[model samples]
Each structure stands twice: as C-alpha cells, then as structure tokens.
Target chain A: MTSALETADNPQDMKRIVIEPLTRVEGHGKVTLLQGSNRSIQQARLHITEFRGFEKFIQGRPYWELPVLVQRLCGICPVSHHLAAAKATDMIVGASELTPTAEKIRRLMHFGQTLQSHALHFFHLCSPDLLFGFDDDIRHRNIVGIIEDSPEIARQGVLLRKYGQEVIRITSGKRIHGTGAIPGGINKSLTQKEIRYLQGDIGQMIAWSQGALELLKKVFFEHYNYHLGFGSIESNMMSMIRADGAFELYHGGLRARDRNGESIFDHNDYRNYDQYIRESVKDWSYMKFPFISALGQENGWYRVGPLARVNNCDFFSTPLAEEARKEFIAIGDGKPVQSTLGYHWARLIELLHCAEAIAELLGDRDLVGKELRNMGNLQSSGTGVIEAPRGTLFHHYEIDELGIVTKASLIVSTTNNNQAMNESIRKVANQYLDGHRLTEALLNQVEVAIRAYDPCLSCATHAIGKMPMELNLCDDDGELIDRLEKRADGRISRTI
Target chain B: MSTDKTFRMDGKAIPFEAGETVMDAALRAGEYIPHLCHNPNFPPHGSCRVCVVDVNGKHMCSCTLEAAEHMEVDNSSDAIIDKRRTLLQMLFVEGNHTCPACEKSGDCQLQAVAYHTRMLSPHFTHFFPKRSIDPSHPDMMFYYNRCILCGLCVRVSRDVDKKSVFAISGRGIDSRLVFNSPSGKLGDSDFSATDEAAKVCPVGAILPKHVGYETPIGQRLYDNKPISVVGDTIAKNHSEKPVVIGGPHE
Candidate 1:
C-alpha cells in the first residue's frame, strides 16, 4: 500500500506553491516554494519586482531643489529623504553649525516621522497575520481588523500619524515635499505656544504607547513557539548607531556587524561605501542586492530594518527605550534572534522611544525662538545620510557654480537587505514545504517572512505596477509536475 | 442714468456702475485721491499703486478695482498707503529712474506722485536689476529697465489693435516682458510701426531706446501738453502739435 506522503522516491511526486502579488508589504514580490512528496523543502525564492533610478533624474536641477525633489520618492518616508538631502547639502555648504533651537526642531520632526511610520508599519501592515491567523481572510485582516477588535489602538494609530504629519507641516512648512527646508536652514520655526500643544499631545500619547508596547510584548510571549519554529538564517546586520553608542533612528555612524556582533565596518564615510557594498540587479526584478564586497550570494547575507537596528545598537539614550531594548534582547538567545518575527518587536520599541524623544525636543526652549534657516553660499558637492523607517538612506550630489546639480546618486535602505530577505524565504520554505502539499498558512508564513524586511519595491522599481512573476515546477525531462496558479482572489488555485 | 454705475463708497451708496472703474466712481463721488497711472484722456492704467485701496481681503489698484457688492473698502488708510509706498519704492529702485537726470522729471506723473506721497528715500534695498535699450527704432527708443509688470502693454498690444506681440515670462518676482519673436532684442520684434505696447509703459522702462536727452521733462509732450490744453479727447489725436518725443506706438 502506497501512502500519499510516501512517494518521496518518485521525482514527479513533488508539489510547488506560488504566491504572487504578496499584499500588505511596501512594494511587490513573490514567494515560490518547491517540496518533495514527503513534504521536505526543495527550493524557495523571494522574487522582488522593483529597481532604483532616482539618482539619475536629479542631474541638472538647482541644488536647492533636491530636498523637495527627493521627497516624492516615497510617500511613507518623504521626510527622511527631505532631511537627508538638506543635511547632505548642509555638510557641503557648511550649514551643519545650526543653533541648538534649529537642531531641536529638526530632531522633533525626525522623531515624529519615526513614531507615525512605525505605527503604520505595525498596526496597518503586519498586525493582520498576528491578530487573526495567517489565511484568516486577508480581505478583513487590515487596520480595519484592529479597529474591529481594538478600536482604541486603531484610533491611536490615526492620532500618531496625524502628530507626525503635523510636525512636518509646522517645521518643513508643508507635510510632503516642503520645498521650504533649504540647505542653509529651514524657512520657519515653531512657536512656543505650538510646542506647548505638542507637549500636551505627547503626554497623552505616552500612556497609549505603553499600552501598545505591552500588547506587542504579549504577542511575542504568546507566540514563542511559532516564532521559534519560523525561519532562522544567520545574517549580518546594518543600522545607524548614535555617537554615544546608542540606538539612533535618524543620524549616526553606520555599523555593519556579523551575526555575532563583530563589527566589520564602523564609520560614517558614506562615499567609500562602494568598497564595502556591491549592488547587482537581476533580470527578473528591479531590486538590487548589495552583497558584501568580494562575496557571493550564499556567503553574503545581511538584514536591515527594525530587528537589525535593535540587534546593532548597544542601548538607547532614553530610559524607556533602553528598557524596551533589554526586553527585546531577552528573546531567543539574548541577542541576534535569527527569526524575522523579531522585526515587529524592534519596531514597536523604536516607536516608543521616538515618542519620548519628540516630547523631550519639544520641551527644549531653544526650539521656539531660533532662526529656522540659515542663508549660505552654494557648495559644489555634498552627501546626506539618515535612517528612514525601513533602514539607512543616502543622498549625494555634485553641483556647478550656479548651484545646478551635475550629478546625483542614492543608496536606499531596502537594497541593503535584499539578499537576507531572499535567504529568509528560502529557510522557511525548506522547513515548511519539505514534501507536502502547500497549505495557505505556510505559504502566507513565507510571505510574512519577506515582509519583515519591509522592502521598498516602489522606490526600488521606480514604477507603479506589479511585475510579472512566474512560478513553475517540472521533472528532469522538463515534463509538467504539480502546479499552483495565482488567482484573482489572491489564493492558490491548484492541481497536484 | 442709463450710462451710470451703482456701488458703495465706505458703505455709502454711489452711482456709475456701467463698468466705470472704482477710481472713477470715487472721483465722481468727490472722493479726492492720488493717482499716477490713471490718465483721464486714456484708459485707466493700474500699474502705479498711488491709488491703492484695500477691498474685501486683498489690496488692489483702485483704478482697476471692479466694484463688487458688499465689498468692504479702505482707501487712504495709513496701512494701505504704507504697502503702496513699498510697491512704489520697489518700482523706483528696480529701474534706472534717475528723476533728476530724466526728461520728464517735474511734470512726470511718477515724479508728481512720489512728491505727493512724500517718498523721502527708497525704503527697500535696491535690486539694481538689468535691462535693455533699443536705439535702432526709427521714431522711438525702448528702455526696459523702468518697465513695471502692469498688463497695460499686454492690453494695448491685443485690445487696441488685433495684435499681441508682447507677453510676460518667469512669473513672480522674476517676471519680465518679452517680445513676440526669438530675436528678443525689442527692435527686432514683430511689433509694427504703430504697436501701443511700446506707449503703455508708464515709466521710462520702455521709452524709445534711441534719441536720448531730446525733450527735457518740462518740455516733453506729457508735461508741456497737459490733458486740459489738449482737451479731454480720445488718445488717437495724432495731428495735435507734435513734441517729436517719439510715436506713442513705435
């Protein structure tokens, strides 16, 4: 008697599952898993579908316009690009000698972005799977789901996002591109009364943020088995660490470390990044993977975004942020948890820290009366580096005597973690798909692992639509094997 | 009564609603106000702000301020005139308007308004912006430095004749009027021998680029030949005693 699971000897008995247009992620990608008859994994790949080209478009524009120009790159993290461009130009033009008040206002804007972006990433993007089980109706598993089960958290998300948007509005002079934030300085400063209002809101937000953190810790503890059972691939981590060796979400020296916390490159000299990072684009996708210099894909795997950030920084400046980091490190071997699930926890901790930092900056009296922007002579070249919600971002430019940009280049954060994301999906695919018919939950789990990277495919692709991703399985003779078709309803319509 | 306009002055009723300008309405209602660009013989030119008034929420040149219903208006107020003084100062500093060295110094409407408003000095910093001169035109010279962004040139070029050989470019503070063709030099534009865009320039910005220092300000046609002496007549009196200053439209 032959069992359905016992056909491992037959090569034709393998099953293939394909998940295309993976939803609830920043951009677009696909996950394809191959398994043998006994449900042992054969192969897996996270196929990305975007490319980066904003650097080429920046040439010939006036240097002062870059902050506004780069802001349109991503709606989710425009302020990051704006600040990065302004700082880069400031470095070139010697505008970094800003007053304490100006610096405080800038930090306030940065913290605001951190809070709102993290909330969106957590409640809106990833909560669906954790709250309801994977494959628990994707249509109903969004922020709306949180609103249904926890209306207060949903409202908090809205309020937090509004606070961030308001900071951008007040500081930069507009919420989006805010063409007013120039190289010399900003256009307008925040008033004392406005700071008091922000302080009041911050006081209210603290309780809500604490509750949210508690909820996240509860989720982490409750799902220990699933998280442990999830994919774990040892990879290098990269993020910005502050001057005093603390976690910094905005500006700092980037430290690229191995899985064991051994720093390979610890410097802020971004122009020399090409020597350490190598980017290559695949024909199937627009996203570029930057492997470690002189290393191939298998040996060169690095992760980024929140989990990588927490694993990297020794501690955070604020006491609350530090306590959260301690709680985060205590999970799974005390440091460098190999599972992608920890990204959510790291993000939540950063969110809490951002709120505290914003309140502190708002209370700084210098912020209310200082000059918003400084007037300066245009510089010939500059580079700005800042950490967006996803990871590190770089903007570099060379300008002519008239301040027209002659050259431009950008190193976005998503590119840094491409290899790790691919490997992450493979690890889970190997563990879950080993010789069995693909279950929707396992397939979803594979997608969720890739989502942990929070790859910005829209910025990567420089386009607005999904790419054509094909997934297929065949025997040695190229004859057809088991198959899964991507359906309009976003499920695997299949035959074995 | 049929040719009259109807509106309010400081919330008091008035008449003269048949498309007559707010300045004309105020003048008809015996409201004395200073003006530089409004010539009774010619159509109202709204470039100069000596007749500026605050209506509704915005400040407008009264010569061009269309009387709308229930429009809260403020004229001759210190705040309104202060802003107008700034605008006039911008015009004075932006151009090569050397009042003492100019041909139409004392009798020039621009100089008279400056004297009336008691403009002691250019309040804002001078831009000392660039300009061009065309001395090659047969009967006139065009000085572009003193050209204000009044739409008078655009209107004269399009409305009086069916031709529009001039248009403004680079909006906001960088705005500049350009000739219709690529040659760009005013002498080489498609402007005919009788294009009024040249004459509508209120300041010396568009004076004939040639024939310099010909008529002194007191002897120039605008100064010696006052409108009452020339009669309150239409602007096309080409046969009147010629000042040989230049053709109004070159």
Candidate 2:
C-alpha cells in the first residue's frame, strides 16, 4: 500500500518538520512532515519509535502466568490484555464454555474495562482536542487545564473512570493487574457486598455515560462540516459481532465491511484469524499493518476499534446505545462513517453501552453464584479475541503438554489500526498544511488525528519516571529557531 | 502434666515441653506468633527474624531461642511490631516481592506478616537486585526474585525430603537459590512435585506452576482473616484443591 511519505520526496524542495514524542497518546510516537516549496504538504508519516518485543519475551513462561504477566504491556488497557489472554488460555484448559457465574463476571469485568478505557480516551485524552480547538494554548490544552477551567467536565470524567475502576476492583481482585479471569473460567465470582458496592454508584454512571454521549454529539454537530471532513478517509472496517449481528465485545466471530458498509466477510471464526487476516510489515514502522486476505494486502488494509465496531454491528443490545448507534449510522447516510473524527463518537457510544450493560449485570444473581471454573482435557493451542476499548484485540497462544506457553502472537488494537492512523494523520497534515510554514497548531492537528485512534505503543520506554523532552522549532532554511525543554522535574524552560 | 513448664507471654502462660522453642511452645499452647521461616514441621531456623519476641526486655528470635519456665516474654508489643515492620521492609526491598503479580500473594507468609505488622510499604529504597527465574521445571517454577533467603525450602529438602534439591548460594544481597542439578534447573533436579520442599517456600520463590491464581486473591489464605487467626500451615487445606497448595510456603 502507498504511504504518505512515499507519495513524494522532493528532497531539494522539501522542508521537513518533526513532532517528537507526540503528546497525550498512550506511548511515544512521532509525526514527520515533509513540505515542498510554496508550503505544499509533501508527506506525513506516523512512526512508532519504541521497540515492541513483548511477544518474543513471553515465550516459554507458564500459560497460567500469561493473563497476569502480559497485562504489564499497557497501563491504560491492562484489563483488556488480562481478559484476552485468559480467554485464549481458556481453550487450552479444555473449557469451551464457562459456568454461568464465571461468564457473567468476566463480561462485567470486560464492560467495566471498556467503560473506563473509553472514558479515559474520550474525556481525558481526546476531549482536550475536541472541546478546546486544535489551536488552543499548548499549556492549557490538556486534562489538567480542563480540570482548572471545566471542573464539572473533569469531575465527571474522573468519576466515570473511578466508577469503572471500582467495578473492576470488585469483580476482579484489583483495579489493574487483576487475576479474576483464569483459564477455563474465572477464579472467583462477586459476593453480596461487592454486588451492593458496585450497584450503589452504577445509576450515576449510566446517567453520566449518557450525558457524555450527548456532550460528544453536541460538540460534533457544532462544527458538523469540519468534524465530518477533517482527516476523512474511505477504508474498510472490521470488528466482532454476536451471532445475530448485535454489537459484541466479549466473544464473537469476525466481520469485515467495506467503506460502503457492504459485508466483505461475516462471522469468520477468530481461531482461524491468520487464514483470513494477514499482517504485512513495513520498513518505516515497527508495527505491522493487518489486512483482509481475500482483498489482498493492497485493498485489504482496514480500520478496527470503535469506529469499525459501531459501523459493523447491526444494532446494539441496549436500547439507549441502540438509539445512539442509529444516530451515528444515520450520519453515514448508508455507508460507514468515513470521518476519522467519528472515532470519538463511536467510542462514547460504546462507553454508554458498557455502562448500561454494567447496570443490567448488577441485578443478575448469577454474579454471586458459587461455580467459578471447569476443566477438561487440555488442548495444545487456543485463540482469544475481544473488542477492546480501542478496537479488536487478539491473543493466541500455543502451549506445550505441561501448559507452558510455547508461542504467543498478539494483534493489539493499536497495531490493528496502525495503517489507518498513519493515513488519518497524513490527511490531517495535508488539509492543514495550506501555503504557510508549519506551526505548532498544525503539528497538533496531525497529533489530534492520531489521538482519535488512542494507539498504545505497548513497549513504550516511559514506563517509569519522568524523562527530559526537547521541542525544536526550525526555520525555513533548516536552522533551529527556538528550543523548549521540559526538564525531568517538569519545569519547562525556553533555551532559545 | 497439669503443671507443665511454662513462660508468661503477655498475660497468658505458654506451656512448653523439654527442648521446645518459644515458637513451638506458643503454637502448642494455642498461642499465635507471626513467623515466616519457622514452621512446626521443620526444625527451628532463625533467618526470617519475623518471630522476634521481647524476652526479659531484649529482642530475640523466638524460634531459635529455647523456651524456659516462668520466663517473661512479650509478644506483639508495640516495639516488636515496629521492628517486624522494619525487618519486613528490608526483606521486601532486598528482593522483588510484587504481591500484586505474585502467585503466592495472599498466601505468602511474608505478605501476610507484612499485613499483620502493618508494613504498608517497603520503607527503604528498593535494591531491585538482579535476580533470576528458572521456568525449566515442568510442574514447578523457581522465582529467585521473590526469595526472602529464609532457608525454609533448603532445610525442608535437606532434612525432610532428604534430597537437598535447593540451597541458598552466596551471602547478603548477592545470595540466591541454586538447584542441585548441573544445569541449575529444577526440571533436571531430583525435586519432585510431591517433595516436602515443593510445599515449603514461605514466599513466592518456590511455586508449583499451572495452579497460580486458581484460588482467587480474596478467598485465598490470609484474605478474610489475618495469618495469625488462620495460621500459615492451613494453606494446604484452604486451597482450591488438594495437591496444589496456594498458600504460604507452598
């Protein structure tokens, strides 16, 4: 597939600008902008600068540890990794079906994970870009600034995230790095006290989730045309759906639809994912671009995550989210919403769906049932798939006779949407480039498009404490004009 | 027999047999003393320092110190809890005891004693010393990272199992658990899953693989109740199933 940088080099006429360690997203990434004479946008490429060798490092570890071990990859979506690995290893333990209590509790945990992850992205991360204009003051364009300026908005976001975290804490053991989901089934089910604790604030969570969706709709419609056209791309979409095509997150078969919303493939088993979906490597990025096999690599490269999930599902099981999904699909006018910014819209809908699902699950008595796990003849290989808050997440593992993880392959949500994210940023760069030199605001727009995907560079370097960051603004002749450094102590100083 | 030799602990008189240590005597008298390395089944080893009791106004390891008749020994005093917390803190930082990720977590004696002594954090800066994990064993995994150097497994394998499969090599921060095999892997060692050493780790160091987190965190040993109440030896019974113990020294 042709990339933005490949579209033009024009070495002599090109003036390059780089946005290093793109801010607010999960991990470190950079956007390289190539500008030609007369400020024509030459190219834009999203490069994942961090090395990801989690799959390689995890081999030979016991299979039981995979659910707890692999989750250290991303602090933001640890539960997604935890659950997906548990699901895959479930088959290895020979449990094709979990007990009712275990399945319900697992679903509750997944929904909670979706609720919190989506809220963090929509409210804390991307909301700054959407609520404040892309050109907002650099210092004030963040969740902290929102807390100071829009305290109510910030409070709701914090509370929403907290509610989801509480659900996770109660269902699983802790909020993060939980050991609730074990092979074959869950380790434990919810108790009466845990059930009551979760139910107490669940009503407020549902209301806040609905309000968040409404808030997104209002912001989206205020600049309807700009939001619709900004960073727009026509691409195929993919996700998992229930047997009857209802929007599903926990378990289902794969579905792929084209830009026109035509089903390219539906209900394809995730166990044979490699048979239908192929990942192609690019020399430019460490992440691979996954595409449909039938369409071939060129046209097969598609988008996943919330936008694809929203577009691919026929309807949502919950009434409120079903109404929201209808409003979302109506914007497409018969096709999938092609606007890159629509990701935020789709993400909020999922957040609402999870909230509603959490409320419904709270009333079920099975959540407090005794049966937690079942075991059968162990299998050698198994695959697990779940619609993570970001997108489709796949965890496949091959175990030895003694249940050691011989091999592991993961298609993280960020990796699945890698090509599409690059395309989105490229579109944003060109649209905002115009006939002027690159500004910090323009650089932010490119980052905003990438933020919509909420990519998690799994093996990101900044897992520990603060690191020094330097922002360099260069002149037309490639001379450094200004330098701003954020020191390890978080003190920002201009060195120019 | 009714007037058996005894030592006054707190306000109660703890009876003891001849050659019985304070820990053994107290446990035999239905008195609880928080300990990590000292088990009833194993001969007394004073390495953990968690069972420190104030005898005649001096801190001493109760497990190694012999019980004497009418001896005034204070257990669970304010000073003792403070020292145990500090000792636990050192043990916590000396090695990686990530209870959140550890399979032994709630069941581990170190964590349970930390909870009992209110050792909320590893007070000192973490040594984060280079440690290793040997996953070569099919049914067992040896995580030297979580090893507290208590010598329970070492003593159990040597004294009980009669195999001496595990031994603590080196000293101080450089100390590490080494297998008896030439390859230094448990899979090659004479250590069987049924060995007493397999169930003797007081921390998450010597774990039986493929059975982790099977008994969820909250329901595991020392979850609803403190280890003082439930006792560490009950791990073999409190687990989800038999033959794969989930608690302390397992």
Candidate 3:
C-alpha cells in the first residue's frame, strides 16, 4: 500500500495530514489528507492495514468447510460469511432449491444476525454521537454514557441484541460460530421449545425496534440540514431484491440503481456479478475498490447497505418497515437519498424488518420439519449471494472432482462499499477542514463520515480489533505541526 | 470379589477397572484428559504425547500408563497446563493446522484441546510447512497440512477394519502418516466409507467423501461447551451419534 503521506506532491508548498489506526470501527485503518496551498484538500485516502488471505489458504480444504471456515474473517459479522459460503456450497452440491425447512431456518438465523449486528452498530457505537453532540466530551460519547443517561433506552437495546443472539443460538446451536446451515440444507430443525422461546420475546423486540426508529426519526427531523447534507454524496446504489422487487436479505437476485433512482439492472442473477462489478486493486490499502463495470471506475462507484437497499427496492416485505421506507423515501422527494448520515435511519428500518421477519418465520410450521437436507451430487463450481446487514455479499468457489476447493473469491459487503467510503471521507475532510486549523473535533468529523457506513474493516481486511486512531498535521515542509489521538477507551488527546 | 481400583485425578477420586489406562479410567468416569492420538476403541499408542500428565514427580503419557490404586495425578496443574500449551504450540507450528480454513475445525480434537488449555496465541513461530493434499479417494480427502501425525487411522485400519490401509513411515521431524497401497492413494486401497478407519481420525487429515459439514458450527460438539467437559476418548465414542455433530457429548 502507498503511504497515505505520499499522495501529496510539491512537498515545499503542500501539507500532509495522516490519521493512523482509525477508531470506533471494527478493525485497523488509517486516513491520509494532502492539503495544497490555502488549505485546499488535494487528495484523501483510507487505508486498510490487515490482510487475511482466506482465499489462497482455503485451496486444499474440502468445499463443505467453507461455511465454517470463512466465518472466521470477522467476529462482528461471521453469519454473513457463514451463510454466503453455505449458499455457494449449495451450488457445488447441485441443489437448485433448499428444502422449505432448511430455507426457513437459514432465514431465521440470518435475520437474527442482521438484528444483532445493526443493534450493536447503532446502540453501542453510533448512538452516542447522535444522542450527545458529535463535539461533546469524547469519553461521554459512548454506550456507557447512554446507559447512565438513558437507562431504559439502553436496556431495550441490550435486550434487543440479546434476543437476536438467542435466536441465533436456537437455530445455529451457538451465538457466534454456529454451524447450522450447510450445503443443500441445515443439520437439524428447530424444536418447538426454541420456537416458543423466541415467540415470547418477539413482541418486545418489535416494539424496541420501532422505538429505535422513532428516536432516529426525531433526531433527524430536529437536525434536518445537518442530517441530510453532512458527508453527503451522489452515487449509485446496489442491493438484492425478490422477484416482485421487494426487499430481500437472505436470498434474492441483485439490482442496481442510478443516483436518480432509475433501475440500472433489476432482478439480475447474482452469479453473473463479475460481468457487472469489477474489483480494482490499489497499492495503498488491503481492500479492493469495486465499481460497476458498465459505468467505469470513476462514475461506477456506488453505495450499498441499508441506505442502498431501502432506496433501490420497491417495497419492504414486512409491513412496519415498509411504512418507514415510505416515510424515508418521502424525505428524499421522489429521488434517491444522498444523505450519508441517513444511513442510520435506513439501518433502523432494516432492523425493524428483521425483527418482524423473525416473528413471521417463527410462526411457520416448516421450520421444524424433518426434511432439513438435500444430499445432492457435487458439481465443479458454485456461487452464493446474499444481502448481509451491511450490503450484498458474494461467495464463489471452484472444487476438483474430489471436492477440494481449487479456487475461491469473496466480495464481502464492506468491499462493495469501499470506494464510496473513501469518497465520503474525502468529501467530509474537504468540507470541514479545508484551509481551517485542524482540531480534534474537525478530525472526528472525518471519522463520523466513515462510521456512518458502519464499515467492518475486519471483514474488508480480514482482521480484528477496536482500533485506536491518530491524526497528524504536517506543515508545507513536512514538519509535524500538531497531533490528535483517539484511544480505544474513548479518550481523545491532542499534542502540539 | 473384584473391587475397582481408584486413583486421585485433579483432587477427584476416579475409579478404574483392572488393566484400564489412566485415560480410559478418567473418560469412563466422566473426567476429561486432553489427548490427541488416544481413542477408547483402539489400543493406546503413545505417538502424540498431548495427554502427558504428571504422575507423582514424573511426567507420563496418561494413555500408556495403567491406573494404580491411590496414585495421585496432577492433570490441571499450572505446570502441566503450561507444558501442554507449549506442546500444542509446537504441534501448531509443525503442521499447517489452519483452523480457519480446515473443514474439521469445530470438531477437531486439536482445536478443542487448544481451547481447553487457553492457548490464546500460537506462541511459537509458524513453520508454514509445504505439504501436499491427497484427494485421490472418490469419497474422502487427506489434507497432509493439517495432519499432526496422531496415528489413530493406522491403528484403527490395522486392528479393527483389517484393511492395513494406513501406516507411518518416517521418524523425528520427517515423521508423517503414509498410505500402505502401492499407488500411495486411498482409492487404490480397499478402504470403504463405512470402514472403522474412516471415522477414527482426530483431525481434518482424513475427512469423509461427501459429508463435509453435516453439523453446523455453533451446534457442533465443542461450540457451546469447553473441551474439559468432554475428553477426546469420549468424543470418539460419540462420533457416531447423529445428533451430536463435532465435539464431545454434554
């Protein structure tokens, strides 16, 4: 990777800014800003530090272990890896359709995953910034502060996550690295007791999800301009949708839309994702920049995740989330939402959808059926795609006749959003810090832009950590002028 | 009347039948001892010394030592755990046991034991050894990279299956499990999917043909519980149980 500092030219006239080990995110990252004369931002880049060579190392292993093995990529979103790998293995096994019981169980587990992940990002990470001011005391802008100030709201968030985790344990047999979904089908069906256990908490979960949406909506309306314009950029959107153009998470064909909300491609087979999307390797970061092939790299960069899914889909399958989606779209005035902070609103809507979907799936009798697996003959290749909590994820694999994985490729959700994330960071840096004296609060503005996407650097770079961030400002001659650091314990300090 | 001879293990008095090894006695009494190569169905072959326990003042392989009356054993002591952790680190370095990529991860006895010993990191440097995979069998695969040279397959194939299909040929650092057939492939031998040797592997080295992940991960044998609750010997006994996927029983 190119050093973030190297992006600037004319060292005599330019100042170099660097943010090492970006904080409040899942894994390690750094940001670099090259400032021209008069404080004009020349270049900005986000760098991913860790590299997990899961694709290369899985070469000699059996195809069936992909679901279990690939999940080790990210502790925060292992289920996304697990399900995507299972879907790909389903193709390797030559199963065109999973048994009803197996499909429902997998869906339940996925919904549970999405619920817990969104809850964690919103409550534990981002809410502190939204609830308190972004420029508030760094130590007070955390989940602990939320618990101290709003204990009831904090309790609901915790319970909501606990409920999602419980659902995962029931379906997959463990909370984090459960091996429930396999090729063709699941290993065991959910028992009646498990169903009853989740059903008892469904009412409370749904209420809490709605309450979260209300809280975000109220905050957005109160700070309409800032919420709508801060870190905002116009880009394309990509997501998965059912045949009816309804919102789909676990399984569906993919769709891409332009900034005006016109369909670029609707209900396209995800197996052909290579023809539409291309990953560009960069020297400075472990993450690959993915763009739409038709539009080329510059114009092809698009956003994914909750905002993209909500904007691209026709309607949500679940009732409560569908209403929230309508209200969210109305705020866009019949156009695609370009607000970056709007991602938080879109996330809550999806969380509501997940809770309702879980309740709906639990009522189905097939979840407990005996036809859990369809043992089919192995094929040479297979691909699986799903809308993970962050966005669309793809897992592709090729196996030999003996079922050993010969080749593998994965496009995780964070990778899909990589280009857009970098763009957002640059946009924020230019808007907030251009020709202005750098401060700890100004640096946080850059971080707020990145955190809006809730990008899992662990998934993108295939590593793990809480990640402490440091920002350094250098004068035109490249001499250090000032420094700001955010530690993992949520403390911010500055040195000059 | 023959009374069972009892031995103290980790402060608990564990009773053993005549001629029972320390590992067998502990397993039968629902006490777990960390081991890799030893299985209840096969005779103890002290090839992998993962089950080394401190007996009185000296260290001995629990699978090879017979349980004697009133014999005090230190299985969970800090020194023994530290020694086992070092041994595990060596095994990890010696083999390409990439648990993240292996199919037999959650069910692998080596991984569960590592968890039990609180091996947070592979303390030693990784050798990153270059090993070849044998996928010649129609229904099974042999990933040599994950092999710890446990020799369970060699024992099970020879004594129970009577196929004489697997063998170990090398010694010291060059030690490795080898196929006995002329072609050096599992397909060339008379090994069936149902053979006793097929289910005897303690790692991902000898995985069955089509059944890669019959059990999902979290529900797998060791996902929810620690390995200390179920030893390697009992995990082998419950390997055939349909409901229990990877780790030992509750």
Best model number under lDDT: 3
lDDT of 3 by residue, A1-496 (tens): 1113335566457787888766423456788888887888888888766577889988877788888888888787788888999999999998989999999999999999999989887887778778886777766766778989999988988899899898888887779887888888898898899899899989999999999999999988998998898888889999999999899998888899998988888888999889999998888788898888988877787899999999988999899999999999998998999899999999999999999999999999999899988867779999999988889899999998778899999988878888788878877877888988877678778777888886474222111113466778888888998887766655667866
| Model 3 residue A389 distance off true place after TM-score fit, in angstroms | 1.1
lDDT of 2 by residue, A331-383 (tens): 99988999998998999999999999998999999998998998888899989
TM-scores of the models, in the given order?
0.65, 0.87, 0.87
RMSD of 1: 15.4
Residues B1-250 of candidate 2 have per-residue lDDT tens digits of: 3446889999898888887789988887878888888777656678888899999988999988888986898897898889989998998888877776788878888888888898878889998886667878878888878888788788767766778898889876677888899888888999999887788677888788777688776777788898888888534432443333233333
Task: Give each model's clash number.
Answer: 32, 2, 11
How close is candidate 1 at the interface, in terms of C-alpha RMSD after superposing the true interface residues?
Answer: 20.3
Q: How well is each residue in A304-393 modelled by candidate 1, as lDDT tens digits?
A: 778888888889888888898887787647557667778778888888888888877876777776565554554678878788888888
Better of 1 and 2 by lDDT: 2
TM, chain A, every candidate: 0.86, 0.93, 0.95
Q: Against the true structure, whose DockQ is highest? A: 3
Higher-scoring candidate on lDDT, 2 or 3: 3
* lDDT, residue B62, model 1: 83
What ranking of all candidate models by lDDT puts the best one first? Answer: 3, 2, 1
